[model samples]
Target: MWVQLRRSARTHVASVKGVAWTLFLFTYTDYKTIFFPVTAFACVAAPVQSYTRLLHGVIWIWLNLLQCNSSNQYKSAEEDALNRPWRPLPSGRISRSQASKLRWSLVPICIGFSACYGWDVVLANAFLTLTTIMYDELGFAGHWLGKNFCNIFGYVTFEIGATKIIGTSTALDYTAMISILYSALVIFTTIQTQDFPDVIGDSALGRVTIPIKYPEASRKFTFVAMIAWSVFFSSTWALGTLSSLIFCVLGAYVGSRIYLLRTVQDDKRSYVIYNVWLLIAHLLPAQTRWNVLPF
Candidate 1:
């Protein structure tokens, strides 16, 4: 009986690992866009949480990210076949039915993991779930307003839940709140950066993204938003002049290139650059948390 129990335990462990690895495949290309921002936000906001605790929180974040990515990719599988044929669905790594089952199965697991942190995290999980539905199922993603807002809100939920889990006290301070709110605005304004690369796919699908619906205006808007946020964030964070200058240059580089570069390949590279700037922007608060002049 003891041997039987041990065998069962091993089997369960292996199953859990299998599920985890499979989930990871769903978001394999999103490490920069999803993982970095969430990790940086948790690190900055949960200054008192030990590294081990923070790492655990990141694991939970990835699980939720996987679910989000799976749903999104499933919804846009056809578009993905055009723009990103290497994805799990387009590449034949997983079938539609199996992916759908994994998507729903992940909800309870995400909620269960959040419940370990408390209601706040669970609420964040709920919100993210709701946003996913509204974005994918409710036709929000087909419009510019819905897509931008959903992306920002979803990102903020990730930050909130991760911070709460690993926070010193699970209560955000004034700085934390302000920083997150500010980041949300930045993301909302610039979330369209992602859309530029998928113009062909989006247009083919009749998805009315900013870049597709208003190409000229959207490029100019990205330039303005990026530069504006660079200056404003330096001020808001009270960064030093030198720090501010560097940040502005990074932002300007991304913004200007995005405006000037019009090729599909150019947009793709520009989007990657934008994400790098975004990752840095998310990490800036670490300087704030440490009370160091990261400006």
Candidate 2:
């Protein structure tokens, strides 16, 4: 019964639903659920419940993104305003009050969901809440050292959280170790690559991001290094684990990098497309099992 109206009037209702469902799919493709399939069962009862879980994931991801965005340094109160005028918050599509209210609302919902899983999940969610507060409210992420700590702790909490929810030690298994390493590499690469789009905005605001500190060419090189390392890691996994799923996942990453590399000269569409491809690669493993091919 979750109806979503489109920006157009004549669009069929199902079309609107399709777009809404797509958003939900991408939103649920987060670190916690990507490997583990926490929200998978919600689809069995009513397709609408899957949509709700997707909405929850999208809201959670956006809020977290906003929280991270606040970590950038700004010169004065005028420039330091967290929400830029073009953003959804400042644009009045959604009010600042609404965002704040929604953030608090989502926290409890996340906690409740985790509690349904187990106490360990609840504890992990508690830690995540604290970390979110520290980054958003306390301005800890602006500090260089604190930024690194946030990166490391964020994944740790994600692993712990999913482990508790799945009710298994899969998080600590060899597969989990590979996943953690893979995730960390992709995250760092993503952070670095994203700097290209925000370089002007961040530099104007006097932020001390890695890309702002280094040359522009270095940013491109960093991406290349990430691609190389990703290939190496995936090949290693295929060799040792011999999982066809590993190769499928690897194909996505390599294909994305190839696309990025070819279109690096065209920054506008290429950057966005590159990110879409990366997301596909990141989430592909979640839905399929890695089967080893018999030679």
Candidate 3:
């Protein structure tokens, strides 16, 4: 009986790992790691206060991940079967009913948590959740523009909630506005590359992503956008708004890498590069606060 119990524990652990991979928890965790710190640093403006808020931010991030990824998986199960057969839903590691139940369960928990922060946080969370529902149920993912818009909306909502939690401010200030704009630009221009890995699945589902809609142009566009982003960050560094030379160097390196891979059609590489670029971008704001390079 002890041996059987140990085997059962191992099986449960393996199943959890499979679900985590299916939900892209690593990517979401990376996003929160970069975003929440920056938001807390920017709003709280003190290390002690920022650290305090960080705990709440972590919970918010996990709730967001659960709400977004699970719903996405439940909605995109059919397409995922073609594009990502290894995912929990597609691989039969989890049932659709289970995923649906998980998603619905997370919704109230997220809203309640946000309510603890403030009405602003609650409102932002509600909006973000609504947008996620629209993106999945209304087939907004069918168009590249719609998909990008959804992403931007989600990120903005996240920032709003974070800002409200940290600063108790619901109004968009200069920093918040700039962050939103930068994130929107990133979502609009570079997020398309993420679809590269799932082209087959997306195509099978008749989804119109940039890689599918403009196969050749997509690479060129992404390359150019990376260059443009690099220049923007470098210029900000020059202007003293961006605090670190490392981010400038990192941006240049990522841009150059993407440029070199402009001709490569590997979705995995594109996905990896895109994630790297995003992490760098998210880290820039935090660097402005914590790791300013003296000129």
Ranked by TM-score from best down, the candidates are 1, 3, 2
In model 2, the runs with Cα more than 4 Å from the true position are 1-86, 141-149, 163-171, 239-289, 292-295
Give Cα distance to truth, residue 261, candidate 1, Å.
0.3
Cα-based RMSD of candidate 3 = 4.2
**Which predicted model would earn the best TM-score?**
1
TM-score of 1: 0.91
| lDDT over C-alpha atoms for residue 122 of model 3 | 87
lDDT of 2: 0.46
Clashing pairs in 3: none
Tens digits of lDDT, candidate 2, 1-295 = 2344443444666677755543333233232322222222111111222444455443433443333332221112233234234433333444455546555676767777666556766776778777767755776555434544565566456544543333233235444545555656555555445444444555666666555576455446655665565465445544334444454455445435533544333433444544554444343333323432331
Query: lDDT values of the candidates?
Result: 0.86, 0.46, 0.68
Better of 1 and 3 by TM-score: 1
Model 1 off-target regions past 4 Å? 1-22
Best by lDDT: 1
Per-candidate TM-score against the hidden true structure: 0.91, 0.58, 0.79
What does candidate 3's lDDT look like per residue over 133-237, in tens digits? Answer: 889988887898889889778877776676656553556566556766676677777777677667777888888988889987787777778767867865653
